[model samples]
Target: MSVDINNYNPTRVLVGVPYVNTVFHFIVGGGGTTLNLTDQISNDNSIGFGKGVAWIASDQAAILANIYTSTFSSWLSSQIWVYTQLPSTSLASTPTAIIPNSQQPIPSSISSELINIVSTPSGLVVLDVSGGILFI
Candidate 1:
């Protein structure tokens, strides 16, 4: 996904590999910086199967990501984690997690998986595979 963060103008593109639970930030015409999720979320034993990613309209410096987690055991679970302060240059940083919302009236709790996300001046628009739209 590509976003226009005023601080990182021109274009900031985010790439993620679910299987490896990795993410990278590439500045157009510049170098790419990898985001290490392992060190940050290892304590929680969570794996990052990136479901969605988007910049926070309220705070461009921050990003929100939807992640999946499971122990590959008899039971499984999923969760959303948040990280911040991505470095501008070399050296890997923690990958940020995401939370989405929609304009349509929705319940206080959201159980559906995030399908995609869009950032607007006001907030984020999240689309779920269940055809539900949420605005945050």
Candidate 2:
């Protein structure tokens, strides 16, 4: 079965869905944050999460992106550096999220520093790394 983000509440700290080959960027207090996706919570990609709508795609090439934070203002006050492609995993992926410098040639892969983590209070987040452009 495919995966989707069920409960991505930024205020309370829960976020995201099971997405594959996707790159998710984040913002906090008007700045960007980093999220270290953990394989610690659960391994199975089965069972549907009950609340979220179609925030992320359930297909293999879909991305589930969101802003996670405990602070209300911080959640609202951040600038996102979106990277649509999964540079680390996919070789042909192009980052539709952020535009690179015109002088610098666009690389076939996404840059590591471009992918920022979603900062939240504390909760179980998810990542699928399957494929596609990231969407919230």
Candidate 3:
């Protein structure tokens, strides 16, 4: 399933999905000049925010770690994994460093640099910071 926040105006937006015994996935999509996840009218906008998990903070470290562990068994797991693609050129400029917001312990076996990021004709980009790229 997908969620479109096109031209949606709100003071604050929050989306929560409760825990389930079965596998579950949530996806959010937004692009184009007319679509946006936030606006001047809102105090804050949160996407895929969760509670009562292994982590408690909304910072990048916790988020990434949770994603890494959940998606790939562990941050440095050798198994191949795939994640949502992002627009490589969507940002105003290339990011200098892709460090997490908070400092957390990551396995030394894990590589720190982004291995590959490819742009697609559909205006989407795939990023693989874990290691090699796995197209889906």
List the global CA lDDT of all models: 0.43, 0.25, 0.23
> What would the per-residue lDDT of candidate 2 be over residues 87-116, giving only the tens digit for each residue?
322212332442234543324443212222
Rank order (by lDDT, best first) = 1, 2, 3
Give a tens-digit lDDT track for model 3, residues 1-114. Answer: 111111122211222221211112222334322323321111121221221111111110011111233333343321111222312212111222223324432345544432
- For 1-136, candidate 1 gives per-residue lDDT tens digits of 3233333343455554443554445455434344232212122234443444455422243332444545423213233333455444321344354332243333546545555666666766766656776776
TM-score (C-alpha, index-matched) for candidate 1? 0.52
So what's the TM-score on candidate 2? 0.18
Residue-pair clashes, model 3: 0
Model 2 worst lDDT window (10 residues): 50-59
> How far off is residue 72 in model 1, in Å?
9.8
Q: Among these predicted structures, which one has the highest lDDT? A: 1
Pick out the ten consecutive residues of candidate 3 with the lowest summed lDDT.
52-61
